[model samples]
Target: MKPIMKISPCILLLLSSFASLTSALTLTVGDKTSVCAATSLIVDGVLDYYQGTTYGGTIGLFKDPYYWWEAGEAFGGMIDNWYFCENDTYEDLIYSALMNQRGSDKDYIPSNQSLTEGNDDQSFWGFAVLEAMERNFTNPPSDQPGWLALAQAVYNTIWARWDTANCGGGLRWQIFTWNKGYDYKNTISNASLFFIASRLARYTSNDTYAQTAEEVYDWLTETSGFVVSSNDTTNAYTVYDGAGISGNCSDLSTGEWTYNYGILMAGCAYMYNHTSDTKWETELEKYVNGISIFYNTSNNNIIYERQCQQSGSCTNDQRSFKSIFSRCLGQTAILAPQHQSDIMKVIEASAAGAAQSCSGGSDGHTCGLNWGYGGWDGWYGLGEQISALEIIQNTLVLQYDAPLTNETGGTSEGDTEAGLDTNDVTNVNEITVSQKDKVSAAIVTTVTLVTFLGLSVWMVL
Candidate 1:
């Protein structure tokens, strides 16, 4: 038994609460069902699986993207593209734009040339053609494609100048940072881009693209430690080099940290799935375990308590939605199912913390004015919420149907585990997932409508 130490009134109150729950209080939503199980039934709308869009109506974050990126120079070029402007569907358009930006290169013309007309954001416009071609093998539409095409076109033009040396090397500015006219590359972002590109290759079955991504991955892992810069801590890559706040890069540490590792982990997992190489797994586990140090406590409470205090400076602190969401999103990168439940708990709890901070309750799926912008026009707070809900939906889809398999019939571990044991009666603490009840009801409604509309349209055909 631990001795009770005297402390501040607030600390005493908090401690008392901890003592009250001597038995680990399982958060039950009712009927002793697992939190994941309860959340499973609460899908508000259908998700566009290929893209992370919600049906019924998108929350604030996915609604409009261009406006969100316009505020920041870092993402300015990428957001202003034809795919984003032309496709009115909110979530998909933004996702498409992000994908194009992540995979962009110079001299690489998008097969979809028309996507970049009438766009004023010149920096990212040119890359559109190459990016679209690389991903979809389709050209831009005849319509007035706005920001998406223009941004992509610009990125491609810049990428062409990138130096691919020694198995794989990245540019200094344009390649990884999207900054124009400079030629410096950081190992972290380059690794991140490579990871995203590799996943795209796996999804699209483009061997050449996959090979390029693999080469890039090889270079980064072989030459660089987790630390991207010499000044960075041992074995850890700084998110950026320019600013102390970003660990290895610029001043804003929020942009660097665990989230980058998460992206890299997910990418490596996908690469491992396609290449059948254990190296990817080894790398993934390293990052997964490495980021754990930042956790506030052994129980994962520190992550919640610290929230968005990356590297001490809260440069872009107003909207914690993206930062928190990144942490939760990273949990799904692991290929093992055994760890799913534990990961889900952390993701769900983090999301709940976000909602609890903003709104009084955990059921905050609806978007409103208070939700601040991040990657898209809608509030990142909402994006955080959507991410959590989508995880639940994705898990269910995998459980009921063995989806997420590679073309070679190899089972991808992506969906192998259903975390949180939604049906487990003994493991409480899953009550948070129950907050999704209304969202699930909305999903049922949307499905019914879609079914009716599809049948009607089919009959006419």
Candidate 2:
């Protein structure tokens, strides 16, 4: 049965958002009340599509067509909304959702979703915890693992899959051997590991994390050739989809994405901030420039998925890419201030267009995918809500504080070995076995031995 959704009343909702969220979202850029109201409505749209499995859904995920990983991505954006908008209307729900999904291993790889998990899928939660850490979202109690530790847990386990044995070195798209894309070393997966490492290095002041980020960049540039465009006229280089190790990562998939360049840009910006290295600064500039391919000039520089959006063929997952990229673009701009004006020009235009697109769906505020299509593109879902919310909220990014570090006021705990003891070790290609199964095997072995001994004795008699 299709679950009937209800519109959340906006009484005493987010700041100055007393207006009902069931109406179209009208925004006045640079006005706090308007931005707050707009984000509040979009956030409501976000929750409307997600009841979480615990809230009476199927299999611990968001609404139909959304993968489990997108839940993490949506919450990560919600945390950003919490940071920028200062609305805790759904704080408890968000926190509980994150904690509940923090698998027994606390590595974002829950037993239910582990069968088809990918490196990028796992890293979505890693990105979420990293967002919590950077945003200083409410920390866990004293004895519980903190957000920083959880992010590291994801990093430790994910980086463990760095397959040096194939195509020199890189992370495969899928984690398990049986999953379909295990042989494909995709950019989003590798970029995720790099993004996490660079973010961690900045937070923990750890040179080791920075080194890993560098090695990841080196592998993509040298081994995979996915980082540098085959036909580069400018210093710009688009991050292609990725390559299969079947051809030694030489036969590139060549699908460019907003998140690929955006993730790399943010990671490089973090690297530049952490080390003050000009090389990282150079990389940052190139990546930021590379993102230009995603924006259409005729559409007044509004971003779109060049590979799929033109044909209106984007998947549910692809629909959410802009939100992640928008968040990262804001981070990159703030960290690399030289690019702030340029980045905001693009973001601000898209924000206005996105606001206009929110006048869709039954509630009249559900966001649409085609920001440049003038008004509503008629698309509405968790992905559109997330992409719109993040872009809208992040227009206020400059007014906020920069991401914190351990040397700064960050209070999140750390555990370098968080995932080391878990049963879901990435190196082990087999499915995880529980302790109960081990005990059952032992009992069966003992009973079989006794039966064999009795049969031998009877034959002897």
Candidate 3:
């Protein structure tokens, strides 16, 4: 038998509030009843943050500190729960939230969010619909655009905004010029496009979508030098944060986030699943190898945000990242089965850790942020709850069929140009920031923010 590790006074306090049988989540993998109970409990915890509960703000959007984009992810999480656990408890709310935010053009870009929303923001809502389309979830009425069409519209808009001139090619983080990070190109934005395109490729069987996914992958790794500077035969490429175009994209912000790595691995899995080609398989191996950096090996292989969790500085937006990462990692396990054992091991461990963290708050079930700490870390939010829910329910992934394709029982319909007017929604091209204007700001801004470019700048997003 292994000896017990002695706990410190501080650590004991952190774990004390959760010392209860009533509220702490508990789970065992491959047990459908256990998984559903855990997901149902945690799913309700996630919805507890919805502003709809208070009737103060919009019905679909979550309460503040949580932004509009993460709400999209929240609904996406519900879709996953419904599919895997066969739980329809939150379906109507999820559908209402999705439709309300879909902009006038029927894209995910709600007009109310136009001022602050960026490419990544819009793509997340698209990711929700993409999830809906791929899983053959309940579709909207005929008068409303189908899930596939809504997702396609978002894909088309972000694809149109792919800037070839600066940083060689990649989508900007912010959609509008006036936004703080407009000059920055981040992995989440580009990786999101890769995700939508790859899934679309599988759903549509269109070579164009696959080609688009490949191009974005190339730019992320090669041209932008943001993911990898060269094809490292080691397959140990570190996915960095982002880079500014002012220095011709030479100044790299090396802060790493879990979702950045997770999204790419997921897209690669989708591509491999579609083609059964070894190249995409190779790509998956590279990224899956790279995924180790996010895990806390000493703590039962629990996953945490490497950059910010330790520092206790993860912003409201950053807090929600693990939810996305865990969701995608689940996708990777489903689409690329070769990696299933390894991925599920981490997910299982993290889910147990997450279950421990959820034993805090008055409800005694509100989740804390860090899962590797053995118990609550005192940090709590919608991000924590959502993160816990995704990892826990994804244990049910193998019990269901892999995400559906158009020819493989998917019933969603599509429209090629469904959201073509998204540019008008974002108002990006309405006024251009000239090169001289861009370079002038980048010179001073880069020098001023050199030390904390990726570190602190994430707060604005």
Per-residue lDDT over 88-175 for candidate 2, one digit per residue giving the tens place of the 0 to 100 score: 8878878888888888778888866655689999999999999999888999897889999999999888888888888899999998
Q: Name the weakest run of 10 consecutive residues (lDDT summed) in model 1.
A: 368-377
Backbone collision count in every prediction?
A: 68, 0, 0
Candidates, ranked, lDDT: 2, 3, 1
The models' CA-based lDDT, in order, is 0.35, 0.82, 0.82
RMSD of every prediction:
18.6, 11.9, 7.5
Candidate 3, after superposition: displacement of residue 243 in Å? 0.9
The residue pairs that clash in candidate 2, if any, are: none
- lDDT tens per residue, model 3, 1-461: 10011234464464555456356666786588988887788887787778865746797787654778989888999898888878887888888887888876787766666556898999899999988998788899988899999999999888988988787889889987777899998889999999999999999999999999999999988888788723566666688889888987889999889899899999999999999989899888888888788885786789988788888788878888999999988999989889999999998888888888877654666677888876666677778878888888887787778899989899998998876754654327343456676677567557755744553444334
By TM-score, the better pick of 1 and 3 is: 3
Q: Report how far residue 2 has shifted in candidate 2, in Å.
A: 10
Q: What TM-score would every model get versus the actual structure?
A: 0.46, 0.87, 0.88
lDDT of candidate 1 over 1-461, digit per residue (tens):
11111134453345445534442112232122343432322222112211233555322122221222211121211222222223223334544544453222221222222122111122222222223332232333444232223332333333333455421344333322112323334443455446445544554465754776766666555543323432444443333321221233222223344444555655665676666677766565555554554443444332321334432222222232243224223324334443456455544444333222222111223211121211111222223233333322232221321112345342222211212122123211112223254466457558866975786566445
Q: Under the 3 Å rule for N, CA and C atoms, how many clashes does model 1 have?
A: 68
Model 1 compared with the native: what TM-score?
0.46
- Give the C-alpha miss distance for residue 350 in model 1, angstroms: 2.1
